[model samples]
Target: MNVLRFAMMAAICIGGFFPSASSDALVGDKLYRNAHIWTGDKKAPRAEAIVVKGARIIALGSSEAMQAHVGKNTQIINLAGAFVVPGFVDNHVHFLVAGSDLTSVNLQSATTPEGFKNQVAEHVREMSANQWILGGNWDHELWGGSLPDKTWIDDVTPDNPVAVRRLDGHMVLANSYALSLANITRDTVAPEGGVIVKDDRGEPTGILKDNAIELLMKVMPVPSAEEMDKALAAASRAALSNGITQVHDMGYDEVGGLTWNNLEAYRRARRNNALKLRVYSFMPLTEWPRVATYIEDNGRGDDWLRWGGLKGYIDGSLGSGTAWFHQPYKNAPDNSGFAVIGSTKLSNMIEGADAAGLHVAIHAIGDRANDNLLDIFESVSKKNGVKDRRFRIEHAQHLSSSAITRFAVLGVIPSMQPYHAIDDGRWAENSIGADRIKRTYPFRSLLDAGASLTFGSDWFVAPLSPLEGIYAAVTRRTIDNKNPDGWVPEQRITVEEALRAYTSANAYAGFMEKGTGTLEIGKLADFTVLSENILTIEPVNIPNVKVLRTVVGGLDQYIADEGPVDLGTVE
Candidate 1:
């Protein structure tokens, strides 16, 4: 018997925990040869060919070796020296929101105040007056760092109520109409972990930060089931096109967390064959009791649509000046940042979730927040007795040296977004000064300390492109080109390391490593055919490495028409 068949039989005899890859069970549907394949498996990291049978990778080796499984009816595709790697597993993303952002007003490129207004004005003309204008990921930092008030957009959106989020999703700029609809006034108090930016004479400035934005959440009408389904469909297409095969979606929305509603929408999409990429949805940790009940009724779900961990915010975000920090901000002296949930309650919530057998993935940005969350995770693990609970710290940015080392000691995953390093590297020193900046997104440090690291785009906040993320990690080049030598260049990693973080590492974090992640025998047949070899290219040119083709589950999900390269079903 062949090794693949022997392995399958052994697995079945051992009660079949790992997926079986029996030769007689499924023959080669397609064979891709003549490729520089990065397997992402350290044991056998490189391969020249791969055979796909059904949705699983049957074998990977030299071109001559893979041919042994090629049946008469099998289709063969010659890669012609192109590069192939495992499909990108983005560790953090907001799925439905990313889809909506695609069709929403394009404010990401709005360079000037006039440009921002013009984009919104143009978009307003196309929408009905009753429809709420949403999703303009505007960044004030690009346009001189002056936060625009309602007055800036009040004139253009007179008929429509607008509540647009900032690029970070930590704050919202509400028009006067939206404010009135929410009944928000100058006297309205901001929530504990939120902020209502005010103007002269203590009047509201239309900018709501962190939990303050939640105050106005319920004012807008909830999207109908049909609308939810449409958004999810758009998300799937967007993900597949970007070469993202799976996403550990930081699922749920601000308004009531929208757990069951969004879960149903994902289910509806799956039932209708509209799901293009795998999604592991996470619920808000604040809804612990409710989410536990939901999990009890639904279990952890399947491969296509998974119920991941409980997600909670340790604090707000850096851009919003609410990320819980140990020291006061260099820019804002009075601010040391505040926690979303108090330390005691935060500990309780995490412990309860951990005890319930749900993995915890908390959003911890600042040093203090990361430390606090780590301490809680340690306590919970000791009390519960560890048994492969892949607890995660989302963003895990801006850490102290102790906190960085603790991540390795506790076996906690530091779920990081590299694009933030380059983007924030442009101006983060101004907020926390040069001293504290050394510990910011310490990728190299984490890896050296034996800690597992995963990469994500934090989509909508950052573009959902693993190529762009890899470029950021490999180059550490600031977006502004201010740091040609790279911002904190010591933290920069190699292309192979970055690829693993984007694929295998992220897969391990999502508990999908057994079935997917590496392009190994018995793994899911999901891979991205690249236009150029990212590993050999100049570090700066990595972003130009286009995703020529994205294949998922033994089927082509995206094929670029711009190129004349013929990737085909050769019989």
Candidate 2:
């Protein structure tokens, strides 16, 4: 019996347990062999070949062992020693917005004030008069610290009503035409939890922060049904190209009808079988009833598209001087930032949503916000008598030492974006002092405290590339190249750890770990093949590693040389 047990262990390591009892009768639909596979399963963490039947992995083992399952019908795919891992799952992304940004003015690379104005001017020339120019994704830090004002582009965009967003999504710069259309002036009082920047002469600077950006919504035009479809298609192609098989789509259009349009668009795509990537959708927390009703009517959707998660914002962002911190920002002595939503209201919403059996994911950027959110999550879970309620804190950017530990204790997942660490690290020290900067984007600390860490792109604000995110987490090198040795070097995590955050950890965060996230039998055959093995290569070269092929549900979604694959016929 002991010898049998040892033999069983070896068989398990080489050939994973078959999905069904009668393993000998099973045959593979596709045989992918001659590859370096990171199975992401602890028991059998490596494999040389995978036998996929339909949309699920039937077996994974040594090339020789898997050959037994490959019958006459199996289509052989020789990987030629390419690196393979579980397909990336971006834990947080505004999907439709990213698609729109791809076609909008390209201002993310504009480093000078002249270049910023030039890009907007060029976009204006292309668009007809009265058309709204949106989705700039401009970074003020890239062109010194001065924020762009309406004056900067008022002359260039005289006819177009421009309302371009800051890269962070916490602020917007509206041109004079847009302000007039919205009826917002120097005298217009900013709404609660928002701010409208004014110049020295008391005139509006066209910069709106937090809730203030909503004022422009009334004047902005709603996207047509056709436009939304195109955006979804564009977004899917982009996600597939990045090797992202799944995304936790944080719903968009907060002011104009609030994601009803976005949700419908996704549904339409799914109905037509147009979705190339899986989506786990989250709606606004304040609208819990709508989401609850949706779940009741649709039964939480299928594996391709799922819902029943609520996303709420506790505060703004650190870059916008709007994160609710415990201490005042070093640059702004009198300001510590404020919560966008009141604690009592936020708690009530969270508790109500929890009672209704919905997943809750709140956005908290500051130390105070994280601490407060943790308290609320703990309270809600306890009151609701917890049953696998995986509460998530989006952008848990800053945290108190206690908050870090409390995440593990309360079983809250920190859904973080690593690129923010490097992007914000450029000037984070100037905003917050060195002391506080030590704890910013502390991936290592969270992992050390036994917290489940997840990674995402926050795309449209940042690029949607998991490789770039992995590089950021492992290297902590700012894009400015100022940190040769890494900016928060102490907080740097290993490449595999970052990959897990992007894959299995994100899968767990979205409650999809059982079906996907690892190259194991009975799991979905969603994985990415890369040109280089990121695990063995130097961390700095990770961003350069190319995604050679991306497969979703047994179908090839993308190929490096040919872009998105059109599976007219499965070979």
Candidate 3:
């Protein structure tokens, strides 16, 4: 009898003996030939062909060897000398927000006062006076050190009250109308973990930082379910087009009305078959009660949409000077930074979440915050008797040498954003001083200690391009080439290492190592084709490498052609 027939007979017997065996049937599908494949499985080198049967890869090798899995009715696709690797997995992202932001007011390119005003004016003109104008990712660094004050936007947004967030999401700029609606005044006391930037007269200047944002955001209207559905659809398409097959989405809060309930919207998209990428949704720490109930009642979803983890912030971000540091900031000597959750509270939360089988991904940027979180992780693991709970330190940006070692020992994954290094490296030293700069985004040190490092682009805070992230990690140089030898040169990683972090490590972080990450047999078919081989390019050129095509689930979803599109507009 043939091996297939023999296996089927054995399956039938096993099914007779054990009723569950009926569910474990293998069905063959098709094959893909004449392609150069990078299987990410370190044991295997590049292969000339691969075979797939029913959603999963069945075999991989030379074309002649893999042909055994194909039948007369099987379909085949020729890669035409294109490179195929595992689909890019983004370890951390706010996918729904990214999609909505794409359609929101774009302020990333506002280089001058005039440019910023013009963009806001255009957005205001399009919106009714009652409607809010949201989502402008303005960065003062890009604007030649000129921070936008209320006066700059007050004139442009006369009718519509605007609340535009800074690129980092830790700070916000509100126009006069919005400020009055929230009843914020110069006398308003800065909340414990927040700051209300005031002018010389101690009057509110329309800029709210960190926890202070709550003072105003509490009053803004919430988006409807339909609006959220639209945002999610847009986000899903964007993810697929960029070759992002999976995302570990850190969800927003319920009280703010931007809750993880958006999963309902995701469900609707999935039912309509509009969801093209897999999303591992995480509940915000504040919504742990709801998450616990949801877990008990519904359990996790299938691969496309699953509730996998819980996300919380220990501290704010460096850009806004809210990161909880051990020492006071170099620019602001009296301020040592603030913590969103106090150390004691954070420890208890981690412990509770760990006990519930929910993985914890915490955002800790400053040295003190990172140290405190490491201590919390250690304490929780020790008490819980660690199994396979893959705890993550989201944006472990700044760390002490001792804290770096704890990550590996405790089996914590550093869910890092590489682009932050390239962007922040430009001004990080100025904020913390040269003495403490060595420990910033210590990618090499973390990897050397055997701690799994995953790469991501904290989208909206930075661009969500894995290619750009790979370039940032490999080169370790700022965009303007300020550090010719590369900033923190010793911490720089190789192109291969960066690629692994972007793919396999990220997949492992999301508990999807078995089904994806590696381009091996039995894995999902997802990969990106680049204009040039990233492996062969010089590190500096990695950022400029263009994406030629993005494939997902054995389907070509995005292809960049050389020809222009017909927009039906006259010259």
- How do the residues 402-453 of candidate 3 rate in per-residue lDDT, one tens digit apiece? 9889898889999999998988988888889887789999999999999999
lDDT digits (tens) for residues 1-571 of candidate 1? 4864666434322322233224444447888888888888776678887778888887677776666666667788887788999999999998877776678776888878898888889999999986788888888888878897888899999989888888888888899999999888999999888899989878898999888888888787877888788788888787887888999888646532466677788888888887788888888887778878877887777778888478888888888788889999999999999897788888888888888878789999999999998999999899888688989999999999899899989999999999999999988999999988999989999999999999999987898899999999988999999999889999988888999999999999998999888987677998998888898989899888777778889888887775325555545
TM-scores for the candidates: 0.94, 0.95, 0.91
Tell me, by TM-score, which candidate is best: 2
Cα error, candidate 1, residue 112 (Å): 2.8
lDDT of 2 at 380: 83
Order the numbered candidates by TM-score, best leading.
2, 1, 3
lDDT score, candidate 1, position 287 = 75
What stretches of model 3 exceed 4 Å from their correct place?
1-30, 144-146, 253-257, 562-571
Where is model 2 more than 4 Å wrong at Cα?
1-12, 15-25, 254-257, 562-571
lDDT of 2 by residue, 447-488 (tens): 999999999999877889999999999999999899988998
